[model samples]
Target: MSGSGACEGLPGAVRVVAGVSGSPGSLTALRRAAREAARRGGELWPVIAWELPGGEFHAARSSVPPPLRERCEQLAREELLDVLDTMFGAAGPGVPLHALIARGRPGQALVQIADRDTDVLVLGAGHRGRLHRLLSPSVSHYCLTHATCPVLAVPPSPLEAHLATVCRRNSWHLRLDAGQLTEREKPRGRVRDA
Candidate 1:
């Protein structure tokens, strides 16, 4: 669908802004954002946010070399392109696509881009464990509280949840039962011959 016509929000055009990080959940969010944009007859804006090794405060304290900063931005840009290519391929999403590489926290960047009241901010509702949440702030929570526009936090896909269970099992050194494996595979029609 052509987004040539103006949308209600954002003065001229309605924007469906999504946060991408190359993660499976983020990929799901990206796909959902595209659909949202198409449904609203708006543009899709996928933003990848990045920061220096030690974040903005550290960079300000130390004289970060220009090359290093440039490299960080370049990597973020490449990741954004890779995600877009993976999702839509050469055909591109039906609506207009505008990719952004922002230099800040993911939540803050997304909230800033989707500033208008009518704009929609899409994010992955990451399935983070307690330790992970302690180490890093929850982007979805940040956006939900701070965003001026509506925030759509997509839940983790079933596959992602299954993968996380497998990882946890592996980390705990738990042996998988052969019968359980077959039982799980049977439902998916991938059972193996004995």
Candidate 2:
């Protein structure tokens, strides 16, 4: 959907635009955006941006089949709705929410939707390894630099980090120690540089 069209029926001039991708970090951002929207007496606009499997250059050369294109769009819409449903349930976020499924790069679509100066863009600043960063562009970094409105990059929750650590260990077939996990869970005091 067009950026302007997405806001056509939504209430409130001030918007808290959230970039959602069904990730735990993105969900955290969505929740924060909802709170911000409620506090500012504005609406929450959750946008999910998607592109073809092979990227734009590949699509340009091979003219993607119409069916495949439609399926991709459908998946994007489903993911957006699923994220909203998973986070807010039937009760909803207790704020006006306008969810959009846009076709393009995540950073660009989010920036475009949150075009107004009054709008606030919220994105997930998840932990990324060197390899991950090398493979994919950082959406949060892009938004922070490019968005005209204010940008809030929400860090992943502690639980998310723990889960990531567990997942990594599992993938690497490393032994998981309950004691180590507990130790990590304990809050740490600030340490001044020696």
Candidate 3:
């Protein structure tokens, strides 16, 4: 409501929520969401969920090794933080960024974030390998299937990445100091070819 929304399908201005899991692909998703929020003059929330690995909860108490287990959990949290730092650093200064940490299933936490806020949510699909296609498994797919708002799946393509960056730079609420959208879009193919 501050200004016209730049990204399509947002009701007006949004409070964009992007889930960061510390995976390489998550940074891609974060960058994309930041751009959208900047372009729309909306708020940006970068959330990291503490998800326990599958079966860890179901294991019997006697079977668990507390020392090694604690180390693994500590490593996970650090990884999440590292990804946040890198993504935010790459986004540079002047782009509004907020960090949120919660404990829950990653998919469930993201879905909850989407449900609570009216902003469009963004998700990243890391290199899931054969398991991804076979399982049809991805955070983006899960959110799109369940979240309340329209979700944007940022593809890994470099051109799409540039569009996201430039889009943020052109955000309605923010000063348009970055390259124009046309200047960044469709870098590889001809306009007609794409």
Candidate 4:
């Protein structure tokens, strides 16, 4: 198994918590996930986890400006919703779509929310070699490992398929580094924007 979190759960109607990073992989994955959500009439939960420079560098700075943090969170929420609209707006109108932005680790935040009712978690694989530490880090790896439900690792456009490849290629390295790994190696299939 991949170096994902230690917990695992059940699978059902495919309620998905798809991470949105606005990258090609993320976009493609989002479209596929949205369409599936539409098909199953399940909730498509979109999440964005972003950390500011202060949070990255000045971790001890409790005096971080409220507005700055708020703005970043707002932007995260907006960007996720926007991506969903731009990719699958047709099915998005009250399509049970929900967008959220967290202030800390993306993977952890996404997992916490998805753990409630999420049956399937979706995320675009990262580029090859980039999955290596300090390079193309993916919180999806964490979700894939920890969530009790079945995880859906969607492949992106051919131009974007490298993420998953690289993720798998770097799986050993990640595990050595204590990075979380997912259960299955490959996803089911690719979903186009509809």
Candidate 5:
């Protein structure tokens, strides 16, 4: 679908898709994506992903009621729009912005959009807690591995930058000491501290 209208095609030659979740990292990603789009003479497509509440499953839908489900969907849409407004501001003039809300896992939603609608995909590295990164598969990671287009996983903000650096350094040394790999082998992304 088009950014603001019917099935009409997009206005630019290139499309930059960014995933936004109302977090600082998402905001960072949105800004970076917008800039990239502008630099490349393209448009920015910001997608927000939301999942149905656990109780809304088909088996339980009758008990949950339709009104509640509709309300939940409405809330998700409003929240996503509010985030776009906050990040892009009222006039948001320079770069054309197309906002979309997809219902599914964030990574999957973004990947689908990237596969069909973009030239480059951008994402933020959310919450830099060492344990968090190690235990979970981040949206950025998912998209990096799956997106058909080029993916840009922006590094964490200044506050988390040092932590990432320390983690990378420590991991590099550990790998050498263990003799599991050679100095020529480099980790794909920032390594998390164990």
Candidate 6:
């Protein structure tokens, strides 16, 4: 369903492309993209890409086991739907959310889709650890450099949220996206900066 439009009634114009891989970071990005689409009355295109091994692409379809490919496709669909369900419950957003599945490298897939049809490309700020950052380049980094549209990178939770994770261990309820930072849970007399 790369180009398939799951939701209708949206104008055929601008689109918000989000790189979703079902990771916690990607899910956070998806929520931000959905809210942006809802606010701007644009289409939310959540894209997930899968790829065959390097040696398998040139092989004929008959050469690959049918069941394996079928299972891969099924899992891809299920994961995409599950992410959607998890993000927004029974009643989805007012804006149209069209989930898309592309076939290629993740970063390349997102760049291709955005170049073709996207107003903004949004992704989560991936692993910031020294080893990971030094060893591997993230999809967000690739998109920031290559994507035609503007890229919005949402960083992971701040220190307060991290402390909450360690101290209270409560489930995440609020997300900080591209919006004002309201004093929702801050203790009295604690001054917070944006």
Local accuracy by lDDT, each model = 0.84, 0.88, 0.65, 0.67, 0.74, 0.73
Residue 62 CA displacement from its true place in model 1, Å: 0.5
Model 4 lDDT per residue over 88-171, tens place: 666553556656666677777667766755466788875546347566456767888887766778865864554555665687
TM-score, one value per model: 0.84, 0.87, 0.59, 0.65, 0.69, 0.71
In candidate 4, which residue ranges exceed 4 Å CA deviation? Answer: 1-14, 90-94, 130-132, 161-194
Best model number under lDDT: 2
User: Which 10-residue window in model 4 sums to the lowest lDDT?
Assistant: 1-10
CA displacement after TM-score superposition, residue 16 of candidate 5 (Å): 0.7
Candidate 6 colliding pairs: none
lDDT of 1: 0.84
Off by more than 4 A, model 5:
1-12, 55-64, 116-118, 133-136, 160-194
Write model 2 residue lDDT over 1-194, tens digit each, in one string. Answer: 33335565354378899999999999999999999999998888899998999887789899899999999989998888889899999999998777888888999888988888899999999999999999999999999999999999998998997888899899999999888777745448876789
- Candidate with top TM-score is 2
Model 2 vs. true fold: TM: 0.87
Query: Once model 6 is optimally superposed onto the true structure by TM-score, how far is the C-alpha of residue 121 displaced, in angstroms?
Result: 0.8
Residue range 81-187, candidate 3, lDDT tens digits: 67766766554524565556655667777777666456778877654468656865566777888898778776665555565566656675667654454554456
lDDT of 6 by residue, 1-194 (tens): 44423333245656888888987788888989888887777888898877654424554453667787666667777888888888888898567767887766788888887774447788988546689778766889899899888888987646535544444333554554433334366576967798
Give the better candidate number (2 or 3) by TM-score: 2
Residue 63's lDDT within candidate 3 is 66
Clash tally, candidates in order: 0, 0, 1, 11, 0, 0
Per-residue error (Å), model 3, residue 75: 4.0
Off by over 4 Å in 2: 1-5, 9-12, 178-194
Report the Cα lDDT for candidate 2.
0.88
Q: Every model's Cα RMSD, please? A: 5.7, 5.7, 13.2, 13.2, 11.2, 8.2
Local lDDT at 34 for model 6: 88
How far does residue 164 in candidate 6 sit from its true spot (Å)? 12
Candidate order by TM-score, decreasing, is 2, 1, 6, 5, 4, 3
